[model samples]
Target: MASTILVTGGTGTLGSHVVPLLREAGREVRVLSRHGRASADGVEYLTADLLGGEGLDPALAGVETVLHLAGGPKGDDLATRNLVRAAARAGVKHLLYISVVGADTMPIGWFRAKLGAERAVAESGIPWTTLRAAQFHDLVLDTVGKMARLPAVPCPGGLRFQPVDAREVAARLAELTLGEPSGLVPDLVGPTVYGVAELARGYLEARGKRRPLLPVRMPGKVGRAYRAADNLSVTGALKGHRTWEDFLAERVGQ
Candidate 1:
């Protein structure tokens, strides 16, 4: 039997892409979902709750590697703790965690929770590889879409983000799953960074909508951290080729 790789949040945005890649690589893919009825070719679905620890034992059976992508919107610290304990109990050989960049340096509540989760994974005694990647392009699109829903789009002044392609990130995670569990590899970031306002404009243009973008100067340490140059990638760790322009162009053509 081929090694089964369990992907938490396998139906989600990033996981959807990762699942296919793993299947293509000839690895048996098992998805842990709440619904547990969804199906994909070369993959199996199992019902499991990360928070409640339900159905994990059966889902984890015969699983050698786990790509843990399930987490709350604002970083539920409790969920990570529970997941770490569950992975350890399952005797999983390698646990791969996807985290955001600057999670340790940022003072935001979400970052704090992520940091706690990272700590838990590190101490879980299970072989683990934690990857800190920049913001996703889909997240950029979501931000713009939310703004378009509002009366006006508010762009944070001096805020910049190095947004990466979800497909690229998923590829890296798949590669890591096939290798030895090295703790906390180098950070992954996009080829370039762009201001939030400019990105919003690009998004608006791509979607064939021109909305008034209101740039606002946000206060606090979190805002400062976003504006800081250190928060972005200055050297190559894992460099992505996709750009916001490419993402927007594809959107425009669609």
Candidate 2:
């Protein structure tokens, strides 16, 4: 029997990619979600709520490893605590967490929450690996898509991003799940850094639409953080093969 691996956010954008990779690597995969989704031929989907702490024991039973890809804009710390507690009780050997690049230093609530989650994993007393990645290409597309739908597209002139492919992140997470726990590694980023305005223009070009580009400065400290490149990786820049242009060309361009 293959070793069972539990994934908290198995249906999410990154989780969607990670699950298949785990299966391909000969690990039996279990997904914990609110909805009791049907299981595939080699997959098991279980019901669980992180906030309520229901159904975790059974979902985590006999699982050797956990790839925690489940997170949201809110309640990151609480969710992580619930999972950490459950995993500790269940005797899970290795735990891998997914966090965004610059989560610790960024002046954003979501980042703060993520940093807290990272701390939880570190202090869990269980062996773990936490990988920080640059913004996913899909997320960037979602942001630019909303802006590109109007007469004039407004973009953050100084806000920079290294939009990485989710598959790459998933691949790295899978590697971590199968290996010994490494505390914190260098950030995985895209091949190039792009300002938001440049990305907005790329989005327009991908859709074959020419729109007026309004470069605007972001307001507030969070905006200042972005302007100062707090969102970018400083030293450990593990470059991903895919770029914003590649994603746009394949996904958006007709």
Candidate 3:
């Protein structure tokens, strides 16, 4: 009999892509979410709260592998710690986690939380694999979209991004989940790196709107990190094929 795989945040952007791939591979999928859903076909949906550490035992029962994709701006460390304790108790064989590229180097609360979560997964005493990925195109779109709404978009000096497609990250994660545990795999990044101004230009052009970009200097340690490209994975990382242009063309239209 095929083993059951547990997926946290299976309904999210990346998880939405991952769950289907695992299902198509003839693997049983159990999605743990904050909301309850009726189990259908071969997928099982369970209501659980990783942050609050509630309803974890029943969720992990009979699950051989765990794909932990759930995260947020804060409390990720605590949430992941909760999940790790439960998975350890459940005797789960493989534990997989998705994190951001600058989790360690970036001096930010969010990145620190992500790094904390990574540490939790690694120290859980279970076989584990972690893939630190660059920012998703969807997230970049959200940021740029909000900026476009303003009369004058603020283009922070030295702010740049490598926006990888969510689908590509999802596919890599699904592949990792099915394979044996490989600790701290290579970082996944997009093909092209774009400055904030360049990204805004693409967005404004796609919308057929032009706004004056106000050059603003970033301040403090955060600014230094961006200037130094601390969030980027320039080399020794697996690059995704899709470029930001490809994403803009498909999402915002030519």
Q: Which candidate comes out best when scored by TM-score?
A: 3
Worst 10 residues of 1 by lDDT: 228-237
Candidate 2 vs candidate 3, TM-score winner: 3
Clashing pairs in 1: none
Give the per-residue lDDT digits (tens) of candidate 2, residues 117-229.
Answer: 99999999899999999999999999999998989998776789999999999899888887888988778999999987899989988888998988787899988888888
Order of quality (lDDT) = 3, 2, 1
Query: How does residue 242 of candidate 2 score in lDDT?
Result: 89
Deviation of model 3 at 42, angstroms: 1.5
The better-scoring model by lDDT among 1 and 3 is 3
Model 2 segments beyond 4 Å from truth?
none
lDDT string for model 1 (61-173, tens) is 87879888877766556777777777778788998889888778887788788888888888888999999999899888888778877777898887888889999999998
TM per candidate: 0.93, 0.97, 0.98
lDDT of 3 by residue, 1-254 (tens): 97899999998999999999999889999999888789986899998999988899999999889999998879999999999999999999999999999999999999999999999999999999999999999999999999999999999999999999999999999899989999999999999999999999999998899899999999999999999999999989999999998899999993
Would you give me the overall lDDT of model 3?
0.95
- The root-mean-square deviation over C-alpha atoms between each candidate and the true structure, in angstroms, is 1.8, 1.1, 0.9
